[model samples]
Target: MTNQQFKSTLQALSLPANRSAIVGIKRGIERETLRITEQGRLSAKQHAAALGSPLTHPSITTDFSEALLEFITPAQSDAELTIKQLEDIHKFTLAHIGDEILWPISMPCFIKHQDEIALAQYGTSNTAQMKTLYREGLKNRYGSMMQAIAGVHFNISLPESFWQTLQTIRQNTQPKQAFISDSYLGVIRNFKRNLWLISYLFGASPALCSSFLQGRDTKLPFEAFGKGSLYLPYGTALRLGDLGYTNSAQSALNVTYNNLDQYISGLKSAITTESDLYRNIGTYPDGRLKQLNHNILQIENEFYSPIRPKRNTAPGEKPTEALARGGIEYIEVRALDVNPFSPVGISLEQVYFLDVFITYCALMPSPDMSTQQQQETQENLSAVVNAGRDPELCLVQDGQSISLKQWGQTLFTDLRAVARYLDDAHNETHYVAVIESLQKAIADPEQTYSGQYMQQVLNSGLDNGHFVFELAKQYKANFAASDYSVYSEAEFEQMAQESDQQRLQIEQSDTLDFNAFLADYFKA
Candidate 1:
């Protein structure tokens, strides 16, 4: 789309129209940092201060030292940092507690195709091939669920039992894998560890859960952990399918109360059946999918609590780690819809827009306010998601209400300024297209993938098979056209083949001992 066309599209979305909200960080100023260092991993002085003897649950009595909370006074002069700017700190943290964060089981398995339609279009039918395909599909699907959870989980209450699990492990010996080199379980371990770190790092409050968990009382309520996106499991997906996107999960308490255990038990189910329902496309009959759906529903029902470090004065189990950190340097944009059309899964333009948005968020002062303000912010977010294309949707900023199109336009104007600054500092012109696309999305929401999804669904009557087929076609076409250096179509196909062979080997192995594998898994 042309710049003029994009601009015109923005005008109708009711977003801010000017450049005041935009703040750009100079390029070469260290956008993001990643390091796994032991040297600067929480200074001895800081750790000593931060780790004052652990607090008792529900009533934290600190020695009034800096050790209890990783507090940052507003006036303290830490240099302003962008989300990307924290890469080094993140890396260091990862290295310090790396193995704790990886969760291999969370990794999606591939589903190979056997027939020509499945093989030619979707790749091979071997276990590895199917697993690879499953992973891609799982990433996109899981990504969507996580995005949803991110928006609302912050308000959910974390349960004490879950928090205790991590704390128990942490106070004990450090897992050998946590400090090992070349750890294959990096991602999952990192995520799990970080979940534990929050209480120590942020002093997260259990009070946050009271409002959402009041009447239902299904043990600990859902918190910001998996509630947003990671909540997928079999039963939950079924519930989501039953409940449209607009309604909150809290509405369906009765159905959940009836079969809670079945739903929870199903979390580990594997989708073993291979009916034609999931033949060529990425869909599968794996019981695991059902379990994932169930998990999401269970979360929606507020059964699962996010594990957090311990806090005193709260009537819950303490997390192994006594404290957690909060205070956002940058909000992780967990909601990227896999552009089934893009080969690398996302475009340079998307990345640029993300960079621009995070910078904008960093520069803007928090819009903190009374309950009313929080409500307004929630409404604005909902509008952006549900009524993004309504043209008349309005958002509030600085005490005044503006149409979303106007707001978007104003935001992008600031974004453009940031992009210009970025270009000058980094000598990078890659962000220009992304800035242009944002401009277009604001002016005409229809240009967005969300809008496109709506259009296709409406045109095709929401047929799942057709929806997935078209998605595959879009992705394949994008793969053929783009020149992303990392993952080529040929490489992807080869990976699928190898994955299939591996699965077959495991299935046909002579000394297969499922019970032994289970024993080892739980023992660790």
Candidate 2:
């Protein structure tokens, strides 16, 4: 695909009957907080009984640590509606969590000790045991503190009709699933090339508690604020930088998104490839399973990319198996931080802007990325995460240097066109309005969430940790006081009861021993 071909395809797809692209967006938010106490220490309490079983809840679950709450929203075509539903989930969850406040920031600020962070416990079922064992492996590899860092994942998928429209434009002769998957891979390549812009614009974890570093060596020159908070004046998102959740082992895999088969093969091989470091730990230690295997990955989900090709797996089906069985059902964007300004962690404007950006990626001419380009992408992401707010920052693109602002403006110009198309298709001006507001952020870095948050903390005369903790309390109060607009109280109660029952049934129905089950799962 070329720029000219992209323009012609956009023109063809803009026909009145084909104008609307049915898009579905899903969100999974993972938040971690110190227990609601006068001292703000990590909580030792289990998942609240009132919030339902973490093992079986449809919309709520635990992630990494027992204190880390993850809320999930079903797919919706309307960004506003999707956010509204997420808000409702927050409202209902807050009402149930007793005194706990949802953490307002991505980096955990108040953790006192690694021993204080408990691995999430899903009950006695074989499957549940596997989940905990995998976490144990992560704990051994990355430490629980790093695993406790929170973020949001945005999953989006274009409908069959949207792909059919593209197929007609391209005269694609392959099977529909193959074409859709290949098209998604192309978009993913472009996403990798341009993700630095997203980190620069939306990254919010610029500062963190000095305690978070735990004496690790770093080149980052830090200034101290109230109560030992460490900050870099021009830093963007340290959470996505070297300080964040990363695996050196996966970096060596060099997974490429050039095609679906290659992507799946890379993932499968990583899952099967044994690691010397992990092998030393062994699969069974002290007569209990330490991990699923000594492989580089416990599962495909552990590959830890900024984005993933997703297909909702069937019962007992592995993620790689699902993609190999059926082409990608969606792509999950994993680079977003937990925006401290929004009660639900993301705003409607952010959602709408992502729609425009992802659509542009789909339509753009994305040449396949080579291994060298992959390394360059990582470098660009690092540059943005560390010093994106610096006016003179430059990013590598196609082996050439470009100013971050120049590339951002260029991308935004194309995004405006996308917004126009979306607005026309939906018979509304909302998408255009989103682009206009984001345009201001591009022109002025101070308008970005990261920039605004830094300024807010500085003006408040509080450490970053204390500032976010105050915001967390405020959000907790607001959500607790709000009425559930999307779900009734009865509905929430019913769902909780059902989830608990499902967990019980799963526990009672397990037929295989834990060791045998792990063996069979890996074999499958």
Candidate 3:
């Protein structure tokens, strides 16, 4: 905790009748994208019924495929008004995407095949056929082109009067959802022990498009380009490394965070265990169901974590029954990576340096990480997502070996005193000039955004698929020549006709049938 004990507990919670102690820094983002085409492949289109109803859109959706998409932005406490509401949801989804584009990296550059992608479609409802049967059980357990890899989540939260001013600066008398679910699991164990300093300061996918290794079998070396790209001259976010969403049955489910009932009893025993490799990938084969559960998690958001502990679930609960009925209400960072030099892929100084590094991972001092400090936080997040700007890199903190620029100059000198206590609780130096521009991307990893997008694809000799397909056609012509400053094209066409009449009133008020709604959603 010491950065002078979090600046004397933010000067005794900035007393002026605790002026709502820096006004509840909420936030929210989500992001994701893909919908390719003008020669950059992917797009087997379909999600555009004039951009809405990706299951009753509150802010457009579609994630595991049907040309990806996923924009969301509601919660806001001005991180430049949540990036001007994600640039007005990418200018109302590029004014209903007529000539596709969006895909500006987090890997997956171009693909001519992988059964030409597809998945996401939500029509008949038993909750939109269990959200496309959980992306057909993630394409029968990871494939449909590694679920078209995309990124950025963010979410964050901190208000119940800033956790009652950190439970009155720790003179604790618990229970307000158990001290905000154990202070959001001590900010997800100091954001998994300093989330590889946010994947070495916003690790942008350092290179790919060798059809995202569609013929797997790496041993590192990489290097090629133009006729099937592939890189690693010190890569940074090979989409959160091990070539994205690494899995061996969730690395044998050794999930634990030390609290929140041992992290919802290891996600309800990986959603009621069972799995001979997802029971030979068959929840229903010939008669086609293909994945609501042969288990090793056909739920609990399939346990992939770069930070989670969220809550907001209700109408028919389940996100572990809203954290076993109200506990950790928000955290969801999900290791970022989708800046692609921001044209709305996120920026406003990377959303005010991730609100000053998630408020210095909720005022530091977090401990409980064991299991060999969670395998030295996955080997310091795979050494900053595979060779973080390699000039003799090194990481793994609490178990020694430092120098990733001296642990990013000791976490930007404690994130410049948490960006000067959030610019003295919002009188605002804009989070101390976003910690002096992230301490110059920790003393120059070529001023980050994955080292200036690998020096703009090595000074534009083009080939990370025509340099992200000519910068995704100049960020879809600068989000179609921008204009919807915070919504209204007749309110996004009346929210695309009320998300297509609330998805036809939840498919005419259904009455259990997709196998009795997956047996009352896994009866628990």
Best by lDDT: 2
The CA lDDT at 369 in model 2 is: 89
Give the TM-score of each candidate. Answer: 0.36, 0.96, 0.33
Worst 10 residues of 2 by lDDT: 24-33
lDDT of 3 by residue, 1-524 (tens): 35667767766766666645657678888888888878777777688888878898888888888888888888867677778777887877876788878887777867767778878988998988898988888887888777788888888787788778778787889777798888788878888888888888888888887867768898987788667787888778887877787675687686787788888888888889897887877445368778887888888887888888888997988887788788788888888888888877778887788777877777775767877888788888887788888868888676778888887887788788768767777777878876777788777787877888878787888777888788888978877787777777788788888999999999999987789877877784
Q: How accurate is candidate 3 locally (lDDT)?
A: 0.80
> When superposed on Cα atoms, how far off is each prediction in RMSD?
21.5, 1.8, 22.2
Ranking, TM-score, top scorer first: 2, 1, 3
Residue 360, model 3: lDDT of 77
**Candidate 2 per-residue lDDT over residues 214-259, each given as its tens digit:** 8678888778888779887778888888889788777889579999
Candidate 1, superposed: residue stretches over 4 Å from native: 1-331, 367-371, 398-400, 454-464, 473-524
Q: Indicate which candidate wins on TM-score.
A: 2
Q: Number of clashes in every candidate structure?
A: 106, 0, 1
